[model samples]
Target: MHAMKLSAAILALLLPLGGCKLVPTDKPDAETAAAQTDEARMAAYADENWSTKVLPVIAEHTVDYDTLQKALSAGVETAGNSYGLRPEGEANPWNFVVSGAGTVTEAKLDSRAARMEVDMNGDGKPDVTLQIGPIIRGTALRDAMPFIVFTDFRDQIEFAKLARAMNEKAHAGLDIPEGDVIGKTVSFTGVYTMRSVDDAPEIVPTVIEVDP
Candidate 1:
């Protein structure tokens, strides 16, 4: 009878200890929970703003090289030193200058840099120039209007691969050459921002002249 009583006491002690462990652990602090919720909400808002507000603006004001020069000439100012090309046939008419033939000497999934030799004023000698920037940075002006939210998560990765692939096809199906667009003239326009190359940096357009 005594032994039975001792066993019962031990069982009662263990039961309470087990219950203590199993009790609901403290939940995440209220502040942490609220912060997490806020972060998620902000991300969603940014995505929505990009699709609805930002993209439309970029479409409406697609810029070409000629247009850019005009805007620059006119002294139209912008923050970030960003400039937009006025639409063709607008009140302030702009002209695109086709000086010479341009070729895509290098192409990548995200970025394409090319060189052109053109006679800006019909000179016989070819003047060499370069065009470099993101591959896809604009939408059709008619479809969405002008929206200027530069986000290229994929292009950044592709750009990292551009230098090595300059002479070879970096993408599986796309053919890129070191000196391919040797005799063709291409037209494109985009915002030029300065970047550093070989420790030298300059402001150049993010969009290079491709097709009109």
Candidate 2:
């Protein structure tokens, strides 16, 4: 009887210790790691598609300069959707592309802005002020909603990669054209933003066709 009581007391003490397993939570499993890998691959594919296909299409269909100018005169609320891509609320401080044929009357390659003067008409004054930049700024090319939707980037970093890829490709494409553009007639397409009618944009072309 004494041995039985001693055994019960030992069992009770051991039971509590065994029951308190306190298993530590494991790190992410193989399945979770595989899922993350698949997601990254998806984002990479989308980013490639944007640079190779989407950007070119958007460049091809840029709004004509005169048409855009006329539309902007009417006000962004009225013209925002019709002439250019508009986000949900404000289109101003937004970006859109423009295209036209012009003579490059002025070219300042070494300037901070790398400014250009293109006379779309025969008039003396430049209708379009352009920038061939050391760094391309503005969201006009990046803000194509349909393309952005198609990219389906899950995070800002993925989207930024998409933008940088497109911008670099465009900059490479523009390098020779910017050289040829000076004192030459050319057909060009570019992007700009409008805060108001008074906002002068330094339009920068993603594509430029030089006429021999």
Candidate 3:
């Protein structure tokens, strides 16, 4: 009886020594969960709409490179209002859907943010730069699309995520070839922002075909 009492006392001591586990009283709310997965949600959004909506709209709105160049000569805002799009109620720069065939004068495929300079007017100087990226800059594609609106998203961060997701989706579609691309002819249809008339347009190509 004494030994049994002693054993019971030891058991009680051990039980008290065992660490307490925290049990959450409530599960995360829907809004909180969404905030945590903003990037993933935007990625899924881009994937769902890219082929069905984005590409078709871009194709429909594409202006010939030569025509756009001529329009740009008039003025940035003039060209933008005539041929490009800016999201309504936003002071975002004009984004253009442009198409052209050109010769690659320089290819910086070695860089993580790879790009190629293309000479469109036979001037042997770069007229437009094509981003061939593992990393792409800007939200030109997203901004150019009339259907994608900033107000439609949850917040600025979510809208920015949408832009990044679109860029990632676009980059995944490119089949960059091996070796140097200098002197090669390529035809492309893509989007660019008219940040400045003097700046060479940097295009994020949706469709780029290398000629034999």
Candidate 4:
């Protein structure tokens, strides 16, 4: 009877400790859950709207290189208000949707993040740098659209992933030719970001048509 009572007392003592665990089951908080999902959400946003919305906005807002140069000569903010896009209340660098036809003066195609120097004017000087990428850099495309807002994202990290996803989309959509395009003429419409009016623009092309 005493042994039975002792066993029952031990069983009662162990019952309260059943919920206690030596290892914690780490549960993600709301912000962490949102952060995990934000990349795919942004990628889906890029995929669904890239062709229908993003491209049309770019086409509508496009300022030719000559026109952009003239506007930038006035001032960076002046040019941004007239022909570029920056998120309201954010210090996002002004991004421009621009178009130009140029002859390739130099092709740096050895790297995955390759670029070309193009002579836009007949002056024979390379005027702009154009990215030809299996790897595209920068968030110029994402920044060029006023519809994409910073506050819409969970955090800066999540917001930056949108840029990465957008770049991947741009690279996948382009039909980059296989050889060095040094002497070829190419017409392009793309996005670029400028911190200063004097900054040499490196374009991330949405469309690049190389002449045969």
Go through the candidates in order and give the C-alpha RMSD of each one to the true structure: 11.9, 7.7, 6.1, 5.3
Per-model TM values vs. the true structure: 0.33, 0.62, 0.81, 0.79
Q: Model 1 scores what on Cα lDDT?
A: 0.34
lDDT of each: 0.34, 0.65, 0.86, 0.86
Candidate 3 to truth, TM: 0.81
- Cα deviation at 193, candidate 4, in Å, is 0.5
TM-score for predicted model 1 compared with the true structure: 0.33
**What does candidate 3's lDDT look like per residue over 1-212, in tens digits?**
99999999999989965787777776568666666688888888899999889998897899999999899899998998889887885477889999999999988888889888999999899888999786888889888887887888888998988988898888789877668778999899889888789988889988788776
Candidate 2 C-alpha lDDT tens digits along 123-187: 86677777666456665556654446523656776566555555545566674444545668867
Q: Report the lDDT of model 1 for residue 62.
A: 45
The lowest-lDDT stretch of 10 consecutive residues in candidate 3 is 26-35
User: How accurate locally is residue 137 in candidate 2, as Cα lDDT from 0 to 100?
Assistant: 65
Pairs that collide in candidate 3 are: none
lDDT by residue (5-104, candidate 1, tens digit) is: 9999999888977656555676677655555543353344345554466334444444544444444553433311344333333343221221222443
What TM-score number comes out for model 4? 0.79
Better of 1 and 4 by TM-score: 4
User: What is residue 152's positional error in candidate 1, in angstroms?
Assistant: 18
Ranking by TM-score: 3, 4, 2, 1
